[model samples]
Target: MQEGCIEWKLDEKENINSLEELARHGARVMLRIALNDEIKEFMEKGETLRDEEGRRLVYRNGYHREREIQTGIGPIKVKQPRVDSRKAEVKFNSKILPKYMRRTESIDAFIPILYLNGVSTGDFSEVMEGLLGKGKGVSANTVVRLKAEWEKEYAEWRKRDLSAKRYCYIWADGIYLKHRDEEDEKSCILVVIGVNENGDKEFLAIDSGIRESALSWKEVLLGLRERGMEEPKLAIGDGGMGFWSALREVYPQTREQRCWVHKTANVLNQLPKKLHPMAKKMLQEIYLSPDKAQAERGIGRFVNVFEDKYPKAVKSLTKDAEELLTFYDFPAAHFQHIRTTNPIESSFSTIRLRTKKMRNCGNRKTTLAMLYKLSQQVEKGWRKLRGFKEIPYVLEGMPYLDGSRMENAVV
Candidate 1:
């Protein structure tokens, strides 16, 4: 083949920008078809809705009103057809478009993502207008109403029954938002994510911290118990979370596992900057050991090396020694998955970023609702736990040695 000037294929008549307009038109047409079909089915071939006696029951009234429905593509003007029935109890209602709906459910969902992205309520119209169309976006008041709706959803989710659920692992975290005025020093959101027996992760709880941390965490655990959540097999969190105390009180049988990542950070914070790299590597060695016995040995090594110079760092390292090594008691394959609260952190990374940029989350209800909405969306993308098959053995309380069942261990 000889090199030559290339000619690209392009259709001069086909304007890509017009595709949206064509789609909008198509949506309107389809909406009419569906509405008409609903009416035809309601009235049937009888010309007017009637009973077997041929008595008139329903007749087309008229369009309720022409209104604009905000959608992801753009706003489309729609006319919801109406009908009146001879029976006072009968009426025509469009399932396709409810009487009070002004926007698509997708639009309702999109607003919160924007809100989480640090878009203020006042900025919603301008931002949506640019994404939607100049004259087709929702108002700030609409955003306010959506907030009320989300609060209701959060309220309902908080009260949901969890009695039939059993989780193999649960991760807990307390997230403190940076506020505008730095109002409450203790304000934080306590989040819990659980891994069910099927190895699927799900949100178990998201509650705003109440008063004393021990009491607040206790309340969260007690709430889970009340809602029928059986005690999880393992609970992973940072050592400092008052969650451990609450866990002991609420589910005494559940095992505790301190996050190695948080543990490393806590220990390093006590050591000199010059020694951080070495100290961190030693901490990693302890947690990354092949088995519990070696892990305990690694801890002893870490202590012997640093106890004289960095007693504080060694103290932090040894204080939660048992919890840090708890991952070894489970299947080897699950060590990576359960050793840290990374699952929880990664899930809320976006929300944390947005919430950090926001000076004030308004109120506890608003903040919780906003976080809940984002999590609801985030949960859809979660993958089943790795080594999910090993969950059954753990649930059965079988003894694990070096990440293998005792029976499966070599002689």
Candidate 2:
């Protein structure tokens, strides 16, 4: 029985080894074929030989050197075709394998995504060594270089023009990251996302702040204004955050909506554990109602049911009552987006997952840069909000009556 088990283990090891070898061999063949095809196309197009004045310059020079490129499958050897052109200096550069490129750009881009997916910098070498072979591991230096590049990218993204664009709605939130140096220290990252006139969501600002304080939020909002970001029609955020206070001071014209998710959680926290499920259902009724009138009825029922026993919970619900139902005034199609700050939540889910595992994310600059890069990656998959076509009407100040355009509304 022991002999059979040993044989099974050996067979499994052999199979895994063979699969990796096969992948490397296949990649080599594909790369060689592609390079050969590029040469053939170049020669056929008369690109190898150019006529300068009356002198003909020939660029067809034999293969200069053989190089090995590290790929996910392992290192694949490639022969670089060189050109010795007289009169006109021309070089044969393969689009498949660029000059001095040891690794593919796709591999470079994937490294950061992997880092943001909860793979720590120290674990990168081990993780990559498993996927790629022994010496092909991603070094710490490479990660540092990538972080530097990402910092430059973040800087450029922050300075982009917002004067030409207008947002219909914005979601604001502050996320805290624990510092490694100090156990008691936590840094707050204030983030804002805007839905444009086209109903497309965009990441607007990500700045380091002081625990979502009114001053911190005001600095962020003022920065947006300085960058030429027009005042959005509505802003959604947690009821307890200082964002509302800052918004009132910066752009009072922008209406406010308290996130139903945050409000529900706050109310539930104040109530008894057993009352949570029923209390949550009652709160949902208020947000999910067809119109403001029905929503108000739902709110009244909740207040009446909890006021006597859970007066504090009832107070939590009624304190932001007007803000909670502000979405009803907007087009019905947009209510789902306006009712909550899910857009910000969804984008930061990756950052939260990664940072929680990290516990202490270096310094404030590094933390903000990491969060910005992670958010940028997440923004790629974000879908346009539903009922996007109505954005123009919203921007035009047309009144929406119970989620529909008001009758005989003037342009």
Candidate 3:
């Protein structure tokens, strides 16, 4: 060691601490110092401390409260200082640890993600315990309480007023979940998503149904009507869904578009495996065409190529020919969104993966609440559709010819 330089040595018995632990300890010390400084400033300004003529300002009462604040490292217990006011009304509130805040917002948000990923409510404590040390994690009772709050939120959301709401487009589908018990059949949950005039996607409805039957769908549509949801300009869905018949009965004027993705899969299912490659390409031509005439020509070529050898496949493709081609009449920029119910499909894909892992969700109410919570989480990532600005024209019943603006068309 040099004369001016200091020497370093390792302590034999001192506990080695990780960087995260040091950072957390530093934050705790700073927080306490900050709160004490706030109290000091109040005390200095107080009339009692200054011996002024006016009534006493805020003064130190005592440290009467203790709270555990959740941080990245773990939950930290802190003593909250109290204050007494004489003339000026004042309250001691630490910006670092807000009143009644058990966990940070980021930590609170993580709970639903864990729940949606198949972590049961009762097991949250175990999961958190692994992340945080023992005794410093969210309790199962807390998770159950949060779930009850979500149930109330979902109930309130379902009954909200939609009288002034109008959607430019709608997508309908029925999601089937595994049977609860061996004796019971699987259940269907009908879902509807809508695109408002601003082209924002919204989860409109999620209801229990019986295998997408006409009556089941009718009840859902009737509910929407009773809730004051105006008939959307166009509805997109799989042709096989019972939604079509019910939609026609409820909102007869609304145009329909069969989802090309569903149509492609249905057509491919009927064809031989060897023909799938060629058949899929042929189906793509019909949907990806530039205009209705081009699409029709593509369909004609498909029919000519497979009508004899694979009548079932060709029939499946041609059955919803008009509905499949409905996208060509809409704005070219919005054709991608209008051609399929992919938005709804993508969102439900998360639910499908979650439910598959869980095998069977609890009861109908519990299942709906979980689904609603999952949708709320998924909706955060949903981007606005392309050509969103053109939605207002669609809502005004503006017609388009070959994906071009048709001037002065009658509404």
Best by TM-score: 2
Clashes of each: 1, 1, 0
How does candidate 2 fare on TM-score?
0.78
Between candidates 1 and 2, the one scoring higher on TM-score is 2
Q: TM-score per candidate, in order?
A: 0.76, 0.78, 0.77
lDDT of each: 0.82, 0.80, 0.80
Query: Stretches of candidate 2 above 4 Å error?
Result: 1-123, 181-184, 357-359
26-55, model 3: which lDDT tens digit per residue?
A: 666667777888777767766454326655
TM-score leaderboard ranking: 2, 3, 1
lDDT of 1 by residue, 294-366 (tens): 8899899989999998899889988888888888888998999999999888977776777666644555667
Residue pairs in clash, model 1: 180-359
Q: Which residue pairs does candidate 3 place in steric collision?
A: none
